[model samples]
Target chain A: MRFTSLSGLALGLALSSTAAFAGEIVLNSDQSDPAPKKAMEELIANFQAANPGITVKWNNFDHEGYKSAINNFLKANPPDVAAWYAGNRMAPQVKAGLFEDVTDVWEKNGLNDQLKSAAPSMTIDGKKWGVPYTYYQWGIYYRPDVFKANGVNVPKNWAELVAACAKLKAAGIAPFAIGSSQKWPTGGWFDYMDLRVNGYQFHMDLTGGKVAWTDPKVKAVFDKWAELVKPGYYIENAAALDWQDAIPQFASGKAAMYLMGNFAVAPMMKAGLKEDQLDFMQFPEITAGIPMAEDAPTDTFHIPSGAKNKDDAKKFLAFVASADAQTKLNATLGQLPVNSGSAKPDDKFLKAGFAMLSSAAGLAQFFDRDAPAEMASAGMDGFQEFMVHPDHQDAILARLEAVRAKAYK
Target chain B: MSAIAAQPDAPLAASWWKRNQLQLAPWLFLAPGIFAFAVYVMIPIVQSVSLSFYEWDGLTPDAKWVGFGNYTELWTDPDFWTSLRNNVAWLVMYLLAVPAGLAVALFLNQNVTGIRVYKSLFFFPFVISQVVVGLMFRWFYAPNFGLLSGVIKTLTGSNIAILADDRYATYGIIAAGLWPQIAYCMILYLTGLNNINSEQVEAARMDGARGWKLLWNIILPQLAPATFIAVVVTVIGALRSFDLVSIMTKGGPYGSTRVLSYYMYEKALSEYGFRMGYGAAIAVVLFLIMMVFITYFILQMLRQERDA
Candidate 1:
């Protein structure tokens, strides 16, 4: 036994990498876009500076590929720190014991107070699995110039929103521009509709698979969605276009409003819409006296269970969760910092989003993030199907119900 | 031989090698190839078959054994049925490449000026990668701004999004796949046409065989080998149709364009997919379908060997 242990120690020593060495931590993330990439680099540089003698090695991946790749690397070649989304999206990893519980870090850093807005999403079974640093509000990012051109007013309720859509359609403009080729854009639409129609708790319950998809409350949400979809208010052929592709239609005044996250504002500006032309609005109220919960999908960081340098990773998470660090990071990211003490950026869209989100009754992560992956995948497809063929609503809802029945088990 | 074996200097290794070398040499030559096929193909197939009986997320340390539960699920799964139907469509439509390829080969097989340039241009699609082909066709069929849509608009005065529309998405991707597949088939036929007996053709022509009759009687029988290969490859291509669908639509617009391979990927490996057992079930079904055709091809080859 002694000889075997000696050999094992020798092998372990030889196999250990530089990143596994004391005072070094490895981070794996998908901040591959220019702005996020830049923000990540700054955060790393700052982290290393603050903790002298410690170094950070980051492996940045492109966004889409990382979602699938994370599964392999987390188990096979785990980094000390990993970036992921908050809420039920992380449930599988948490449940499977892949993510290290950072509840201690939350307790020590008093993040429960500083990051209270995102606490519920970060929690699973009364324990925090990750520390969320940033989130962007999902709402109506529209062209006010197009609304004015068509003599339309801002919609504040379900009736007004439908009326506005009709007027925009009459003026030869698609009321909504949705590029749903990726299907997640449709998820955003569903989240808003559900949150507005049935309130956050029911939406969460439905997404959590506790509520049947065939429930009347669920049908009511679809009914509200159908009002916009069946009236030819949305751009035609949305299923083939990507979210970015729909931006051109909105920017060119072909479509007046886009229901998307605030990340869309940068692309809208790049598409040549001026600040005055671009505007943000909360999704109109559907059911009266249902406290308007908003969708604020949070981005987070976690330590893999297999990580060697746990202490340094915890430090990194604490640093990331701080108000000052978040202020600088979200400024560069053009998003709202999760930390309540962090100064909100003065960007016109961010300012509006921060105010709206702060005053909101509650928050839910976007549909794809809030639901279990299997349910989210099927549910989003069902949403797109219903949008294209409203007459097949019963069929689509039944299919989703069946998927829910199987998926949760 | 007994005296030599008894000699002290006679090596045991040398004699043993001499005795068995004739039989062992072929196996030695085949060792690397056999090892590669076993490692890369055979092992994975076995593992996938085993995995189909277990529920795995492809990440967890333990996978739950579910017996034939995955297969039963696939049996009732509507998406599986849709994928199977689309694959059938692909198989039937993709076979048209063989005749289309032959027509192009016949058209290009002549002594004419700048013929090499025309031949190269005709062979262009196959030379480029499948990814580039999918992208080009995606652009061509894009709704408001695509070239085909523009033409269709002027002629019919109706906007059509081919890739988004369920009725057209599968056909659009199939058309994209056929562009390069036809080229590959043409190359095979062109080679077969070159090796045809010129003297026999002349003799046939002298006997008043001409045009369709002469070509049918003399030329087609000679190109049977090429036709066999073309059909084999086309069927395989049709069965494994994943890339074009992935790049163009990702089996989207409510999963209307999902083939079995793409569906398996979606269920097993893609961003939202984690059901390894279910994916393996889909893969097993696809493999069985391929096996039916593969068996026929192998039997045909064996019969031809007997004939020869």
Candidate 2:
């Protein structure tokens, strides 16, 4: 009875607030972690200080809940600005006209030049829909001390990587630390392999379901992955562990490397590894002529079409796009700022990540973000299966092809 | 009441409301609860049945009439077959909880100094949320550091990651689910034993019945209601086995662990992007399968009611 009354009171308050907008800008974000939450609060503070007349209201949600909640929130009582992803992750929202076109804001703020690298990801139908704040590069985070102790060179090619894994195994260390229980960690391996083996366009096409999973190019990606999987280079029972659970293997020196996004650095450091103990390297070259395309999943802010405070939302977006804002935000996030003019973070991994991402021929959003959710789910499942049973390559690809056909339709 | 009773004895026409009040009062008392159930539960089931015949992503304004198209698609979808097979496996294996619970209840039914503590300790798993149970089992079956893996390694000279292996993943989860379910059934049986007719058992013993014979001839017949409830709950629990699979494997190792509930959720809500109509179709199929057992159980319940 008490719970019902309390919820009723909450509903009443929410309805009243939505009914009457008091020139306040409401921002909903999925930066519920301590660090990212703090960064968001600081960004709001800076934004409010810059525009004193504007009052900002921020509602933060946990990462997982936000994904399921966003659609409902957007359709119902959408905030003025909300945090979302880039690439195909954002494309559906753009198509439904649920996200506001922020091209004018981009043009007015000179973001075309400032956030040029992020333009292609943010644009839909030749118009920008959102401004990307931060993205982090994916690469191999390895224990240099272990590599040195094992007499393993930093692998630069497919053969070298294979040889390094063999040497690591010989030295009684696991070559890779992975946890596929969540199924997405396996997607990372597939993404990097596909990006290298077939380059960005073919990889993107495959994820988008434009290219069949049974195609030779797709098969080549799996064949390369099998080289590592068949050798038992990865830690055992990866499918039973989360990404965080796999970190102990690398931190305890049982495993030498982890191919992960830059977000993993802080966790690795927190696990008691010193800065000098660990280093980042690009996923090594596979196909000689194929250009290097990096996985740099981006986080961005956008205006919902149903927003009451359009002017303030535009102001917030413009303020967030500034070099000052992106620099402050990404510094706290420990990620690479999307703006070219933003001051680079001084951390070694961040410096390396920024360089790797900037030097890449193209940026493919990570597998889950790049593909439609249905295909991503099926693809990740196949990837995890392949990791466990690489010999089932043909059957897995055939299954994936069926899912792709259905999802695209 | 004194004034009304005195006045009601004076004229039949004036006392009609009082005469009918007993008959009307019960329905009046039940009206609110019945109305709530109809609105919240019955309406949604009807809505879902209708939704199964359409193609609509949850977010969309328009729903396209698909008329059994989703079911036709499911006919060819291998995941549907996998989920159905897993459901059958869950139902068959999960029934082990009944016998297992009976054994535990029999063991703990003795009057001892620390018997209450032992009973509570055995019942602890049911009190823990299934999410916690799932996590605990995930840790237990985790490859390197898990307790079970440690035992396996000691015995076999190699570690086995049960949840990671497609062949054993569903069974591992079902085992975890059974730990708590058995506890639940044991508590029910313990209560049933406490209420058993002591005189009948003594008479059975006097007639030379002993052990299993005593239990079968005397105690078991008296515990029919408890057994019925336990079987019903266990069957329901087995059919609705989603949380464990979701937490442990997420229907992974190539979607080998998916059951109807998890598949329906994945189709409608998760990163698969909302295929609400497709999800509804899956739910309808699950509901139909459940109806078979539900109908049989209800018929047996009706027979028992008639006899009573």
Which candidate tops lDDT? 1
Candidate 1: list runs displaced more than 4 Å.
A1-24, B1-5, B8-14
lDDT of 1 by residue, A131-193 (tens): 998999989988889899888999999999999999989889999999989899999889989
DockQ of 2: 0.52
lDDT string, candidate 2, A11-130, tens digits: 999877754543799999898767788888899999988886678989989887798788889998999999999998887677777899999999999999999988988888999999
Residue B187 lDDT (model 1):
91
Model 2 vs truth, CA RMSD: 7.0
lDDT by residue (tens digit), candidate 1, B217-252? 999999999999999999999999999999999998
TM-score, model 1 to reference: 0.95
* lDDT accuracy of residue B248 in candidate 1: 95
Fnat for candidate 2 (0 to 1): 0.69
lDDT of 2 at B176: 98
RMSD of each: 4.8, 7.0
- The DockQ score of candidate 1 comes to 0.70
Q: Candidate 2: deviation at residue B90, Å?
A: 1.5
| Model 1 residue A73 distance off true place after TM-score fit, in angstroms | 1.7
